[model samples]
Target chain A: MKLIKIFSFLLVLILFSNCHREDFLQHNRESVKSITGTWKIINAVRNGTDLTDRFDFSRFKITFSDSSYIVDNSVPFIVTQNGTYHLDDPQYPFKIYFETPDNFTKELDFKYPTTNGVRNIVLTFSPGCSSNSYTYTFQKIN
Target chain B: MRKSLNYIKRKISWQLTIVCAITALVIAACSITIDSIDQSDSINGGETMQSTLHVTISTNAEEDNSRLMVAVLVPKVWNARNNASISFTSSITDGTQKMTAVPVGTAAPQGNGLDWPTLINNKIGHGGNLLPGWEWAAFYSDNAYNVGGNINLSVTVNIKIKTSQDNISFKLGYVVAESVDGLSNSQYYNSAFPGCFRVFGTGDLIDFCNPQLSTVDPLNSLDNDIVTLNFDGGIIDNALANQSNIFLCAKGITTDGDTLNLCRQDSTTQLISQGIKKWSIDIWPRGFFNLPADKQLASIQYYFTDATGNVKVGSTGDGSTPFTYTFKCQ
Candidate 1:
């Protein structure tokens, strides 16, 4: 009887020691939103008319890197020259500021909307005449 | 595949027949037919432009407290809302009936919650005007009458629009419908596009009626924007119309009254042929003129030329005049 009790206790101890460990659930924190990297024109409009097919905006690109920016094929953009750009608010951006090398800053209203599960940065500006307003939607390429 | 295609065609025929029969029924219920429209080809600015609309309405359904509706498509610059008046004489009415501007925001019956002007605009469209800046002006009879069932009535609408002194050419359109049916059904309304009208006032001709040899897209542009200068040689005979190779000769006027001329007949200024005598060049004013970073352009005056710089074309389709495009934000 003594031997049997000793064997039972050893089996229980071995079973408990060999059992797998339970993992505690961990929460995944949200990532910081960004507008960096190269963006190309995904869609464009003029005076409420879709100009995507009417005009060739395929080569237009605006690359954003930290504070400074550059333009590839210039369309009627906010700033014509190579300039610095920043969001009004990083967390809840409503506007963007583009400052030229000469310190000429042009404030532009922008909307960041996700289209078809992809983020798009929309900018509206009147390059030629005030009556002709153009909205350009950009999507990140790299 | 052939058997399947034949079966599809048979099914489509039956469906089309049914759709046509239903359309006929709807049209027979309440329909307006515009018989004619009489508008002047041209009128002097600051004067009143008169027009007339002849229509017939046949209805098998009774509508109570319904008013006659008339709408006009005109240039926004005309400000036709406050400058126009209308009166109608119908076969059923004893005397001439007065019409007042449909108060802004007055909802049209059966228009799915849209106002009379909005509904008319959405339904009628711009009457084939190519450029922007046009609107529809809608008016309603001052008094509503109980239109009897199974009755056919004829109406003659007289319209007068006081003009603004802007030398412009535009297409004129007229529509006739009743307040009861609105523009809900194509059969419920009728329209007449009487063709282009002209207001000879002052300033450069805003020709919307005919085609031009040299035209600019976006009608407005800035140095930073890519402006397309279109040369349509097919429409009219010009010096460079028969030439296959056309080049651009342009002069950019700076903000400070400096001119940058690029009149070379090289590949840099050559226009891309879109086949069929249509040539176009998309140019960035800043780059094309080699404009410095500090300098800005106020406008550009340009003309089309052929190889060897001998043949040239300008605003005057015959190459006598140069076309000027102003860079403006307004």
Candidate 2:
């Protein structure tokens, strides 16, 4: 009787562990990796000067989902109006683009770095002159 | 035995630390100094300006064969990399020596992977110029010369730049270093500032040397940019000086000849006081003017106002001509 009871417990544990692994694998295979989230600016720089504390960038936020993007409180950004977006290489992106409704696209130098256990998106572009470059760093508003 | 000598200095990077052997011209480590700098205080736009810098270099070794490097910091509008010419003459070499532009990405030796311009600008400051845009154009001697191991030499570098047709006041700076040291430390290079220079031309004066009553943080930007407008109530006696609250009244003229009025005395257009009678406000042109996505700006003409928006102050402090910011790129 004791041997039968031990054998039944092991069988149930094996079934539960196997079912959990299968569910995890199935979820991973079905979902595509994306940068779909509401992101807010945490830092800003003009040329080489840090303007994070000097200027007010608290109201700016960007939301990216699949192929669509929306901007709130637009600053000097890649595009004033956004309709769609894309990465130069989604897996290892070096550039990102904001595509307006009319298909007018603006490309910006893109950088993704993990810091302090948090991932960030850094975009650099010159809104006015190429001599004056601006960098904006964004973090997911989770 | 070693001897350290003092020479005329126009900047900190130009300070030469000369250590010499007692009996002969043997340099344990050769140092550099700028004895004198000759440049004009004023140059007219659309013309070529010529300047000469006299430098002294102590040779590290007779076998130290390296190209001499020189760089100049100038406004981007001049496009010094394309329009400027740099050459030098030395006691150890023949009449005129040729120098060519150091290619864009050539890393400076001993610079820890920094390029010549970046290394120089980081080590040497902006020569007291206040404006944001400055370009450092570096050059290298066409040929390498091992003049001698035991030698002290004097060099004169001639610089000629074709001034752009914009009225500008800039504090000119220069740096001299060899290919080997590459501005690794202060001992490796010498830098100098000739002083404030001005080019008399058209448009409003883009003065980098002096303060202004009303100035923009970035003198160049488009309607899509976040621009900071600054007003110095202390610099001039304006009508709104007594009021604690200052506002911005601006008219943004679009590229399509449409004028957008953004003048209001509410919270949005209020300038933050930075004390000492200084006031500034950062505004996004697109959002400030409430423009449609397709519209673009040509220029913005603005003025400072009081609480009721009655008292106004412009470039002339009395609203004669509005302070204007024109969109431009180079």
Candidate 3:
């Protein structure tokens, strides 16, 4: 009975150690990649206007790398803009930020709360005009 | 086979342990987190962010074109909302010399002629186009006539921005008869009087009026002169017209005040077929309001009337003949 008890204790200790080792290995492999690619400006709206102008339907396109982006105002690559971007992810789901030369910084947050399981992202910004309200939505591609 | 399997297991275990250690290190290195995020949802990133935008706008009064140009400097970051919506307030300088010159040597639409009524109609405060807040008031200083026969006249110009409560007052200095010799030095040529001048009947300075001093040879001989004016300082190339007709007239104000008796009195004695003489003054501003910013160049030309009343003969204004310099802004 003494020998059996000793063997049982050793088995428990080995299992516990192995489990912790596996957990540590798993954590090491987790890494988030920086997003870089083409982004489409789905829609833009100027608040407080009588909705008389066709500016609401206007769409823009942008391309971003790790460092810089461009705003194009011509055809084929209509309204290509270049700017800088940053990221914030204190919470589980990460947030994106963009700053243009016009001294405007857009802090983008997800409209629908995301969790660790979320593979796609949608961020929104506010204060579209001089008013207290704005909403800019962004989606992750690739 | 059993020995190989055991060896592989050992290697896998060691790899796992290394990976776990690296992971822990990474998390520890990146553990820092920001706190006290802005709870209040302020628009435009708050007042501190909005105040970062800086812009300076300058408006130049081009009374000749009846337009005021507003120049804006947009910092590289912020884009302009509506560049076309920029506005301007008008101002005028009338140096009390109602008698400005008319160039008879050039063709109509490009030159000034004996049409005093129309010529006087197109100035800054005239033509019924004076802005509501812009009033034409003339003030003179007795300094022109002191104890001695020394002339030191200075005219006061009041420019008020009707849209804003702010107003600016500047003085346009005049020249004395003795200082007339200063005209020979192009750098120091000014009108006898500077400031807005209303025609005798009208209460506003003519929209297109400029300073004029004339001398005539009434006996049809260049040696016999009627009036001689020497400018102490004048704006080099600023003009009321994109293309201006500059002139130096020897004029006589008739007692009737109905007709302005005038003749082209050139320094030369020979009388050309067409009597009227004209000049075209061209000088572009070196740069915007900041004068010392650029190197400026100017050109002067003299014209004599042809049979068709067109200016044909062109000469440089080295002051060899009676000539006037008219400056225009682009």
Top-lDDT candidate index: 2
| A1-142 per-residue lDDT for model 1 (tens digits) | 9999999999999987876554222233334458889999988877676767645577778889988898885456666678888888776788899898888988888798888999999999866556567898999999
Lowest summed lDDT window (length 10), candidate 2 chain B? B1-10
Native contact fraction (fnat) of model 1: 0.60
Sort the candidates on lDDT, descending order: 2, 1, 3
Score chain A of each prediction against the true chain A by TM-score and list the results.
Answer: 0.75, 0.74, 0.47
Rank candidates by TM-score, best first.
2, 1, 3
Candidate 1 per-residue lDDT, tens place, B1-330, comes to: 999999999999999999999987764588899998877789898899999888898888777899998989887667788889999999989898999888888888898889876787787777787655677888989999988878889999999998877777899888888887788788889988888898998655666677777776655457877677888898877778689899999999999999999999987798888789988887768778989878999888888888987677778775677888877532
Q: Candidate 3 residues B53-147, lDDT tens each?
A: 01121112111121111111111111222211222111222333221112222222221441222222233223222221122221112122111
How are the candidates ranked when ordered by DockQ, highest leading?
A: 2, 1, 3
Each model's fraction of native contacts = 0.60, 0.67, 0.00
Q: Alpha-carbon error at B62 in model 2, in Å?
A: 3.9
Best DockQ goes to which candidate? 2
Q: lDDT by residue for model 2 over A24-78, one digit each (tens)?
A: 7777663323678999999999877777876678888889999889998656776
- Candidate 1: give the clashing pairs: A129-B329, A130-B329, A130-B330
* Candidate 3 residue-wise lDDT, A22-50, digit = tens: 78788787465445665544433322212
Give lDDT tens digits, candidate 2, residues B21-89: 333444446777887888878978888988898999876666466899988989878888889888999
Candidate number that wins on DockQ, 1 or 2: 2
Mind sharing the TM-score for model 1? 0.66
